[model samples]
Target: MLEAIYSHLARRAAMYLWMLVVFVAFGRYFTLTINVSDSLPGTVFLVQKGAKPGKGDLAAFRYNGGGPYERGSLFLKRVAGMSGATVTSHDVGYGYRDYFVDGEFVGRAKPLSKAGKPLKPGPVGLIPEGHYYMAAPNPDSLDSRYALVGWVRDSQIVGRGIRIF
Candidate 1:
């Protein structure tokens, strides 16, 4: 009876180990991110890097522009405009702005940062190939609305973000 019990335990352990190995091997294509900013709903997310991100997809990317924010820091935002899309913005008064993609109004933008400094407006005109415009759910979010993060290149994309919690 004791031998049978040990044999059962050993088989269970081996199965668990095999499962772990499979997870590790296939999981390399995915990443986990914790949203610390209010740009989107704060939650843990699963990101997949298997394909190119598209407009309306949530994406995780590295910030490559100069600013107080560190380079290579991960930023999560929604893809608002893609290659060949004409992007534009205008002052909407009351310290707020509005953005457009392909002449369709997208969202309102904050004119100033939380520090009270003026935020640079997003780039205007067609987005080049391999470039994307990112936007946040919150109007006050510091995303592609500012020059600091005007457009993201395909090379900077880490993956497509999927909210897990």
Candidate 2:
């Protein structure tokens, strides 16, 4: 009888350990993001691992280089132009650069930073394969309009941002 009790306890312990392993795996692969930047509205985002972000999808990626912000920082922005798309910028007026993708007007690029410093405009012409142009509806947002956060590569993409609330 004692042998049977020990066997049952051992099986239950093994099942619990397996459950813990699965939970850890899921938590490590997925994350919840609380967006604090005005680039997008404040919301809780559910980020899934390995999700491919297409045009118009809000994505999180690791910033490769440094500029206004720290390097290796995770940035969240909307995918404006995708692979094989054409992105262009033209000075509309007052030093504002307007962006267009595939001949469609996207948004105006802010030439001045929040501190009144000039910002470098993003690249123009065809977006090479495996890269993406990111932007936000807010013109003042520090996004692809500046060279700091230029075309994001697919390999740098972490996951798609899904608004939870």
Q: Could you say which candidate leads in lDDT?
A: 1
TM-score, one value per model: 0.83, 0.83
Q: Candidate 2 lDDT, tens digit per residue, 108-147?
A: 8776888888888888889999999888877777777778
Among residues 3 or more apart in sequence or in different chains, the pairs in candidate 2 whose N, CA or C atoms overlap within 3 Å are: none
Error of 1 at 39 (Å): 0.7
Off by over 4 Å in 2: 1-19
Backbone clashes, each candidate: 0, 0
